[model samples]
Target: MTNRTRTPRTRYAQSLICLLFVWAVMGSNSALAELTIRITEGADAAIPVAVVPFSESEGIPSSDKISSIVQDDLAMSGEFRTLAPEKMLSLPSKRSEVYFRDWRLLGQRYVLVGALNRNGDRVEARYELFDVNREERIMGATAGASANNMRTLAHHISDKVYEAITGVPGAFSTKLAYVTRDSANGEPRYRLQVSDVDGKRAGIRLESKEPILSPAWSPDGRKLAYVSFETGRPVVFIHELASGNRTRIAEYRGLNSAPAWSDDGRSLLLTLSKDGNAEIYRIDIQSKNLKRLTNHWSIDTEAVWDHTGNGFFFTSDRSGGPQIYHKSSEDAEPRRITFGSRYNARARPDNDGKFVYYVHQRDRAFHIAKTDLESGEETVLTRSESDESPSVSPNGRMLIYATKQSGNSVLTVVSADGGDAYSLPASQGDVRDPAWSPILR
Candidate 1:
């Protein structure tokens, strides 16, 4: 009996050590994930773009190419259809060399050109944006950063170009957190990970022998809240990244999961099944006081807080087959947000609180969708067989979700307006339950 007790302790210590060591070293080296293109649902049209190969201004080698990365980033947004240089009448490196008439004949609306040179410890990049129809250079900028920082610069350029065209802030600079599962020796393992907006830098933040679900990042991007079954029962844990400290937020007798952090990072709104029925609950982070928000006798989980912190949107089966309902802190009466679907509904509000996004499963296929809360108009964003757990970008103009493509679970990103669709291959395991972190600086 004593030997058996020692064995359990020894196994737990090994697991903890492994988890800590892997997480601590995750940020040291970033690895790029391979890109996989997929067709998106509800795509209206693709914008036409022309990107000529960059020019060389200074005495720099010819091998440090960045235009390819920029092209991939823009194409993945699902909004832009890139024009091949082979199809171009002329490859222009400077504004003077551009033949506006040739591009206009190709139905191109915009054109991009750039120059690159090696700086002291970084690469100097300069790019220009032009309006093909007007024959005008609308925007121009310069950036200088280390070679290792090229990816960051490319994302910034994407943000600028996206914003210039859409009249909304682009979310290309954001990051995504998600859940991945692995099977080894007939046992299942789960891990929580974070990656770049384009699905690069895939690294694990936490791992468990049991299931880990519903990962939500704090508004400040310093912490994460998730449900882990490490203790043989579902519980909520808040993990701080900088200090490597983890604190148990909930370990009640029944279900304690689906943690969603408030916009201000002051509290967490989660679902607890302690009262015999799954219901939404809000817990103050500082005081640790628990407040039962919904008294409904139906299953209510996956609570998402409003940007104002005055209300939250969640899913409940009260009306049969999960539907979305909005509950206000000012009043206990819940208002229904989704009225179309009869099978499943999960609400994920944008950062600005102007839109409420969700997943609608119809005819055995799940799609990412959204509702204009003010207009009550529903738009289906994805038409895939399975797309779930969407997290909106910081600017709320883009989203990342988990989907099955070619029989493999992978992470996919699409414009919030449902434009471009692309996938990120998992470096280690099958990925799911993606959550985008709020911008942190």
Candidate 2:
């Protein structure tokens, strides 16, 4: 094989080969680890907004401040610069108390204020947003949840405030599915976890000593489909989040990996090697019927559905090195979509169909890059040298991917246009295979 051919295989396929070989020899149990987010870069033109601390009623128990969560959510996006509570001239809990002059003097373009009250077994929040320049209330609402679900209530409020101000729905309430690996007593432990977009309230869904890869979320945000090797071989399983129930979906003999959910959530696009070569296949989730999509001698894997479910994008080495290809339909001929890099894989397209993101290797470093679908112009989105597994937010305003930080794997979030950046590093070990969940209904 030529060096170009060997490089793609080594960078992508070799890892799979090694994982399969290692899973065949060894196996253990796993545990959960929470991720902590830190803002690494801020956008030059970020909007200035003030989120005042909500006043709590008498006798209400102390808990996490809702305003703090909202500030973190907005600041983490890199699109907003939130003013600290200590810097505010006055803490307003309602529209009447907000002084537009004071906010404008502080250079804040917008302000959010609210109050919390106890109502039986639940907590109710009355929140309002004001435009400092216009001196008018732009949005106001009353939202409540069980007292124990304060975080949920806070995220819901953040979503509303974000939508009213940005004209785009916020993803603060969305979940992220990823794989975390760490050693326990010298034995490697693998865990599949789901957490809020800010890396809080993380809960373990599956654990194994064998490596887990490719955690894909269903359209409805109720389940996850991923590849696991706990049975001494890689197998695809659909895990129901609410019940902790897992159903084996793909357990072929040779290779079963890279499970991706369809837009409708009725079927999946998978990469299997049962026929002797790794190629793309579609399987009906309910009927268990399998249909092969690609017939190729070269490795074809990491398949993902485009904005429209009628087509898909996958990584294939058919030409020489691993490049991205798209098929209009299952029976349609595949058309190559990337040419600027010899190693471009893990295709993730935005929901609006404007651009497609993936891992692009330039020189000796790998970075996350995107191609404008209309103009075919490519732009590198990240400066990190070891970036992979790009996932776009539901609104297509932000992109998340895994990269190496301090010689450890960490997830980073950047705006879709490649502005502002934040890092979500694990408390221990490494985190990879990030999958952003769809907007909850």
The stretch of ten residues in a row with the least summed lDDT in candidate 1 is 24-33
Model 2 TM-score, 2 decimals: 0.94
Measure candidate 2: CA RMSD: 3.4
lDDT of 2 by residue, 178-252 (tens): 988877877788889999999988988998878898899999999999989899878999999999999999998
Best by TM-score: 2
Instruction: After superposing candidate 1 on the true structure, give the runs of residues whose Cα lies further than 4 Å from its correct spot.
Output: 1-44, 56-64, 351-354, 417-420, 425-428
Give one digit per residue, the lDDT tens place, for model 1 in 110-229.
998888887776888898889999999988899877866777777777778888887876666777777667665656667677777777666777877677777889988989898887
Off by over 4 Å in 2: 1-16, 19-32
Error of 2 at 319 (Å): 1.2
For candidate 2, which ten residues in a row score worst on lDDT?
23-32
Full-model lDDT for every candidate: 0.75, 0.88
| Model 2, global lDDT | 0.88
Top candidate, metric lDDT: 2
Query: In model 1, how large is the Cα lDDT of residue 95?
Result: 89
